[model samples]
Target chain A: MTIKTSNAGVTVIKKLFSRHETFVFLAIVIFGLIITVVNPDFLTLENVFDLLKSYALMGTFAVGMLFVLISGGIDISFTAIATITGYVIAVLLLQNGEQLNIVSVFAIAGGVGVLLGIINALIIYYFNIPSIITTIATLNIYYGLLTVISKGKWLYGFPAWFGQYTQMYVFKFTAANGTSYGLSVITAFWFVLMLIAWFVLRYTVLGRSIYAMGGNSASAKRAGFNLLRLNLFVYGFMGLMAGFGSVIQALLVQTVAPNSLVGKELDVVAAVVLGGASLTGGTGSVLGTFLGVVLIAIMGNGLTLMRVPAFWYKVVIGTVILISVGASAYRRKVSARRRTIIEVE
Target chain B: MERKYSEFLVLFFILLGVIGLMWLLNGSTFMSLNNFRSMAFQLPELGILSMAMMIAMLTSGINLSIIATANLAGIIMALILTQTIPPEATGPGGIGLVILAILAGLLVAAAIGLLNGFLIAHLEISPILATLGTMILVSGLALAITKGYVVSGFPPAMRAIGNSTILGLPVPILIFAAGAVILSVILQRTSLGARIYMLGSNPLACFYSGVNNPRVLMSTYLISGLYSGVAAIVMISRFNSAKADYGESYLLLTVLVSVLGGVSAAGGFGRVSGLILGLIILQIISNGLNLMGVNTFLTVALWGMVLIAVMVLQFLLNRYKEKRRSI
Candidate 1:
């Protein structure tokens, strides 16, 4: 009876491991173990919290990208959107001397995001331009306009509440070494954003429509899904996330530098694409994206802990993207071949 | 043919409009010989890169790795120049070394292109994803090798390709014109070029029609890479140095130029002449902006605006033509 139960447990484990997210989780564990072995400090709560704090901004962006990729599109403009919106808000706050609360800040940012996202949707839908091309053009336009207007200036000296908000820890404890550490409030934002994304993608009809459009747009249209509405919602959601992410970034860095955010789109793209999100759309999950983010954060942290040169991090990330993307693409080809009808009577 | 010429005419008018605006803004300064000379000197590296991007986009694909490829190729050439050819050398041997270094750089680019092709064609990876992957990997390799430093100090003769004038025209411009001619020939005259357009319009149909689709793709990327190599030589020579991050902003400008030149983002339509006109229009805008002492960032914004404007205009024009045909 014990053997039978053990066999059943083994089967369950195997089934879980077959999932993409679980595989990524396993990779994280094994990689973390290796890093911990190399540096005893790697496993400590202090370091883990540090990693999370650093990646929260990227995590928010990844969730937005996850939506875009799932809808069979790509939006490289998010970084530019985030930067411009954050910079505008910062400049305004600096000029007006108003101590706006965090909620107000987010609302303003998100409002701006929706407006820009609608523009993206309209151009892409009405002009029949590819999402990537449209975003690339918009990215240039938004970033250029921001930089031109701002003269590439950096803004700081936020309202008094900014510090208080960012400084608030979710939980705190002192280490044996007399150093205190806790996850930052910003990480909470990331987590909440992730949960929202997961709920929307997993259970909502809108999410289902997005997936359908991604899987086969023609069929989705035929099935009565409103393509324009879907495009607007998906891209608007992306922009909204970018707005939130921009604020989180500003809070973390304590300044708004217009040029800082535009070039970092690749990191978000890599993280989402690594998580088994098909660029052609119709497949991806928040859980997988979470793992993907964790995996990348770990790799970066582990490499640093191992005393590897920072350049290798990019090499590793690049190789990981290629391998994961290549493996899935190869699998698709095999499945497609298998689906071909054969006459063997 | 009439449709093609009509597109060119639209671009020509836009060019004239920009030139007129710049002339009004800066008066004689914009029309000065020095400005024209500087623009001529400045345009080729970007133009070459744009052409490289154009070839890829012609197949409804993109090589996000074009800038990365140029950097890597330039870095390789820089390494060769710094390592083998001493900075002070001036002789046939030095020239030979320069040639050799250029060859090595081009070879590296070709290899990267082949890798991209293999991944895209045989492995069935999407062009964007595959090229993006290569872009990262190659950039990482470059950063690893250079440790984020610039490679400089080439022999004087090597810099001539960038800075020198040949029979009253800048060498870089000459090279660009020559390249444009060659590319035009290839696109207009070669069977490979015909296959590229066909494949771009519809890949499955091309495949079913007995065309070697993969071979066409491989050749396309190979030519694109070679163009990037040429651009690299010009770039490193012009700057008298090479860095992994050089021309980082050129990637978008190349795309902007391609689109402005009438290259369809969806693929299968573009021409060398149209591309030249696009290049000229952008150069004029940039030069004009500089002459007016306007912020450089605004130029970037204008490029984006121009791209969108052109796209929308084309869309409207196509719709109008359809309506006219129905009538």
Candidate 2:
């Protein structure tokens, strides 16, 4: 009897886990497996590091965006902010003419990001313009401003220290023939940032407030929440992350182009939605977004391995977005109908 | 009394401001007949799209799929005219062929719009999400059909309709005027239009009052789709080529024009006259920028700032009205 009870408990736990996000997580893992099998080199330490480096900056932006989306708002201009701040840093480096330090670049980029975020927060919080429309407008404005400031020039010739900083290894392992593999400092930083973001969203008071506001702003307001202040902080946080993201991006690529991040907002939004954030606001998790990013990256990696046409990727991404959102909507209808039936019963 | 005119007043001021900027930057060139004529011709396609958006807004549903539908229809029309229509009978038979082509486009757009309405109104999907799905599907179909190539070789008469001037005004401008008149009458004088406004303002209340909410919702989307078809015709005529990507740029511009024209984004309130003025304001801004030789990239920034200012002004005006009502 005791053995049977224990086995049943294990089955129950497995069933519960399988019900939510488990399917998606399993899908991602299978995708990774398929890619690795298709190209044995895909599982190499060096290739893994390359993949991590490619996604690090975008992952950071996704972290910040998770906060905004959880609070029932979105920042389409985040990527634009990243590009603009990167350009600013590029300009400063050029003007400094070999005298630039990493600290200076970081400071300029962070400041610009915060400033832009504040502007976005102010308009959205105070004026009551829909976040979607406001962000769309600002996305264009920010990119345009970047173009004007840069005069359509690419920024290159970064200091060797900056490059080394991005590529610095946190840990190294030697295989048989003295070949070494290592995790870069940037990847390590990204992992830590994502973990902290996860903690904040899961455990903090402000984090709870974000969920509360997203779930129902009326109740939150009645409960004495300072919505305007929260709005500012949320947008500002996104901006700061975007700034940091830009710095990492600059370091990784060793160059900045004004149009580098064009049309990237859609990708971030897609990842967020795929992770289960409702566009109607409230009800998502940081872990979900992270998983979302992972899933997208895996899809791209898998498609490339299979040599799928580039255009088909758009079709796939668009289809995924439609299906996920459609499923969510259908689920809501089912639940609502169930509630009505129970009430009638 | 003056408060009732506030929206129009603000729009008029914006128009004057744009005109004054044009004068400051390009003096004589800005006011030249040729430039004005060109602006007139270019305004109609966007104008039609904005009008379509307004109809959707009145029903509290947005059709982001308008551009997609327009693109699909334009491509189909071009393909039929260029590859399918025979050469010898291209004159009178071409007229019949063009009408048939337009009918087919309208049917396709209407079908897509109906699907959108069904999903949004009956199935209880969010309007934005529902329309976005259709936007993707329709645009994909357009791209697939054309393989992303421009279809040209429209007959001369159709080209003439695109290029002809009437009473010193371009044909597109004339079409725009006709559309504005017809739509304004429909919106203000018809019971169906009133029912749409009622449904948009409060659906539950409208239903309780015996309105067929689903029918109203479906018809609004259908009308918007019809307008999209009309816009596609004008677009093909003006450009003399049809491309799947042709309508992509107009999506944002259409929404901007509709919202900035005093059409409430929350729906149930708008005027065709206001939309017409809004289109003109946007066109003048674009044309003025051309004359001033402003960098293309900066145009987005400039427009964003202008939109924000207009939004702020609208917010303040609405607040002022509420304050007065409370007093």
> Residues A121-177, candidate 1, lDDT per residue (tens digit)?
999999988888888889999998888788788899987777676678899998887
RMSD of 2: 3.6
Which segments of candidate 1 are over 4 A away from where they belong?
A1-18, A95-99, A341-345, B85-93
Give a tens-digit lDDT track for model 2, residues B1-327. Answer: 464377678789989998998888899999998888788788899999999888988877678789988888888888877888583485563776676676787788788778777777776665766676677667767776777789998876566667888787788878878888888888889987898888878888999999988788887888888888888888998888898788665766787898778777667877887887788899998998988788977887877776677677777877888999999
Clashes of 2: 0
Cα distance off (Å), candidate 1, residue A257: 1.9
| The best candidate in terms of DockQ | 1
- Counting only residues 3 or more apart in sequence or on different chains, how many pairs clash (N, Cα, C under 3 Å) in candidate 1? 0
- Candidate 2 TM-score versus the reference: 0.88
Backbone clashes in model 1, listed as residue pairs? none
